[model samples]
Target: MKIKTKSKKVNKAWLHDHVTDPYVRLAQKEGYRARAAYKLKEIDEELHLLKPGQLVVDLGAAPGAWSQYVRRKFAPRDAAGGGAAVGALNGTVIALDLLDFEPIEGVHFIQGDFREEAVLAELQAAVNGRPVDVVISDMAPNLSGIEVSDAARIAHLVELAVEFSQQHLRPDGALVCKVFHGSGYSQLVDLFRSSFRTVKPIKPKASRDKSSETFLVGRGLKQQA
Candidate 1:
């Protein structure tokens, strides 16, 4: 009888790549909660997406890096006397995801599915009926590796993000959503165009070149309210 050993060569390779990745090291150095911070930071730098004191909403804000960034930008400061003073025009951020997140200052975290009406209602309440200045959605479906199915699911999430933006975004507000290049991408882009004055597709520096994921930045949202 021969005994066979299983070599976790692939797992080792993955760990090696992750450990050596520059973004991972940067995240640690910068005190970010996750490496995803670089992704949004790169996107914002290129797009000029976020502003101090602008109300923002974060979709799929788990692990809280994105929330942390938004919170810092909009976090309230103490006034001269003692009370909290308005920082950045008293900007507000509402962060939502299916998984619960530890609270970040200036961010109201809502743990729920965005597709649910109750969740949307909760998000609306968090916004307090104020039109949002920017909406950033990094939602992705739990990959099943069935390309078509996964693409469709992610596309649906993009749709929900767009719908939420329509209801919550102010005139000239912007939206950034992560979408995969497959199945219904074109249709989704078309919808975005119809709702925004400018819709551009972007592959940020932090995004892996091998990955099909990209962000759609929709600017100048049409205000129905």
Candidate 2:
């Protein structure tokens, strides 16, 4: 009885906060599918990582808010960049996720788990030997509340993202990976530092204040061979 009551209170509190979130309201007004778009926007604006005519790979990209943002940036537009919603896109966006979403204009979507070898092969084939300008991964494991196991899953996803970047990203390309602040956080940062010439850790305001999530941006890959 006590547990049920506590759970109800927690749900109510979360709902209230989500309803009043400014980013959520802004996302709806601007035609984004989710509030997550602004998180990537803030990160992109800070680093200037996105540009027209670039080939971008989005991993764990369900719902596709990040891909949408990149699509808009690639579109030739007026000063506000709101002139055209979906027209001729100048860039390539390949998105992969385990869950399916309604198709977006000019985005190639692959539905599969990224951890599987077959899925990885499909994603690589989609690249078609093009120089990937950026590899953005928002992959996250279903949390079980066991810190050790959860941390391992998180680390594994980030490691795979880094490895893919090493193989596919252009020498001057960048990688944006989502990571939580807990066990193994520092190791991920170190991995990024070792692989890229420049590594930055950014915490976007659009991310909830209570969330432990942060982003690691690694640019300009180091020589591997």
How much lDDT does each candidate structure score? Answer: 0.82, 0.93
Measured with C-alpha atoms, the lDDT of residue 130 in candidate 1 is 89
Q: Would you estimate the TM-scores of all the predictions? A: 0.87, 0.97
Winning model by lDDT: 2
Report lDDT (Cα) of residue 50, candidate 2.
Answer: 93
Q: Tens digit of lDDT per residue, candidate 2, span 1-225?
A: 999999999999999999999998998998888898898999999999998889999998888888888888888765357424588888899999999998989999999999999999999999999999999988999999999999999999999999999999999999999999999999999999999999999999999989999999999999976
Model 2 TM-score is 0.97
Candidate 1 displacement at residue 204 in angstroms: 1.2
lDDT accuracy of residue 72 in candidate 1: 59
Q: Pick the candidate with the highest TM-score.
A: 2
| Regions of candidate 1 where Cα sits further than 4 Å from its true position | 1-7, 75-90, 223-225
- The alpha-carbon deviation from the true structure for residue 15 of candidate 1, after best TM-score superposition, in angstroms, is 0.9
Badly placed stretches (over 4 Å) of model 2 are: 78-83
